[model samples]
Target: MAQPFSVDAVVWDMDGTLVDSEPLHERVFYATCRRHGVDLSDLDAGVFVGVHQYDVWNAVAHRFPPTVSREAWLADLDAEYVADQGSLTAMPDAQRIVSTLHAAGMKQACATNSAGVVVAANLMTLDILPFLQATVTLDDVKEGKPAPEPYARACTLLGVAPERAVAIEDSITGLMAARAAGLHTIGFASNHHIAAKPEFHVLADRVIHRLDEVLSLVTMPAAAR
Candidate 1:
């Protein structure tokens, strides 16, 4: 059995952890690349999973130069995501987990590397914004995932110390950010598109296959954590 731990606040990663948006992101990315006549046949699409769009674009541009400017490429991707907001559904039990924690009087927030525009579209489209007390996006931080600023910003916004908070994430970058920020980390590995790997298990305090498992982690009381 998993040991109980005190959890006063829950910070979530917006992409794969809360919303099933990676597939959409990947699709749009490839479509945009193709439009720019950039051939990514040899590139691993999985590399684009958890990082910021600009970082992804920068890496792509460095390897296979795109015809469009960074701003234009980003705008195109963002517009595509926003227009396809209907496909931005929540991960299984993600809504229940958020609502359950909220009902239990726990503070909650979303910390993401995504831009505010995309984050707003995803959360608002999925009706998750109301349940989140705060959201820290790349726009709100000088540095994003793998830098700890996003999660740190979120903890600050929630007025909760990082040690007392739990962060759920689905990507290596997100996990690194949460752990580096001093929050207990849970790796959500149920998404087959980004299945849990060795590094994920190593980084997370615990790994859960479903979002519903977060309920127990938050509700249970521990003698010591």
Candidate 2:
């Protein structure tokens, strides 16, 4: 028999899950890499999808050798993305679902591998910051996604047990972290950037094609599930 789950809280992964920023991320990263003298013509950008920005930098720096300091490269990328903030938009039904969950008395929080500054910007832009009762950013956890610390911290802050919460993630990396933290995971596949992959579906406890689909899962009674 499948174990019953009672969800009282929803933990969200910000980047590709709630915000449509992966294209912006890829553009900035590629430009930054090229400026730093790294040749990526032979490499597919998809490999970096759903990956932590810092981890991507570290891996690329190690593999190709960096002509610029990692810190400098990161600063440039962050600045560029921030400057292009007008391009950032919430995922389809993102704000509606978040507000609906909040109205339904769900304890909601965001756990992301993005830096604190980036998190603030994205949340503010999406206008969903006020609905999130708690937020765990990359700066809040020493070990980010794939390590479980981010989601663990978010659950702790929300005062919810891991098994009693549902984590919505768009990347395989984030799914691993949510599973490690013992939260029921939903793969948000609003776009083809990352969660559309088979590995994501395999890892997620549930796969949702639209943000509104989350409404049913979180609202369903434990007995029904």
Number of clashing residue pairs in every model?
0, 0
lDDT score of residue 60 within candidate 1: 76
Writing each residue's lDDT as its tens digit, candidate 2 over 137-218 gives: 8888888889999999999999989998999998898999999999999988866757657888889988878888787676
Span of 10 residues, lowest total lDDT, candidate 2 = 216-225
Task: Encode model 1's per-residue lDDT on 83-106: one tens digit a residue.
Answer: 888887888877877887776688
* Stretches > 4 Å off in candidate 1: 63-67, 220-225
* CA displacement after TM-score superposition, residue 69 of candidate 1 (Å): 1.6
> What lDDT does model 1 reach?
0.83
lDDT of each: 0.83, 0.83
RMSD list, candidates in order = 2.7, 3.1
lDDT, model 1, position 58: 72
Clashing pairs in 2: none
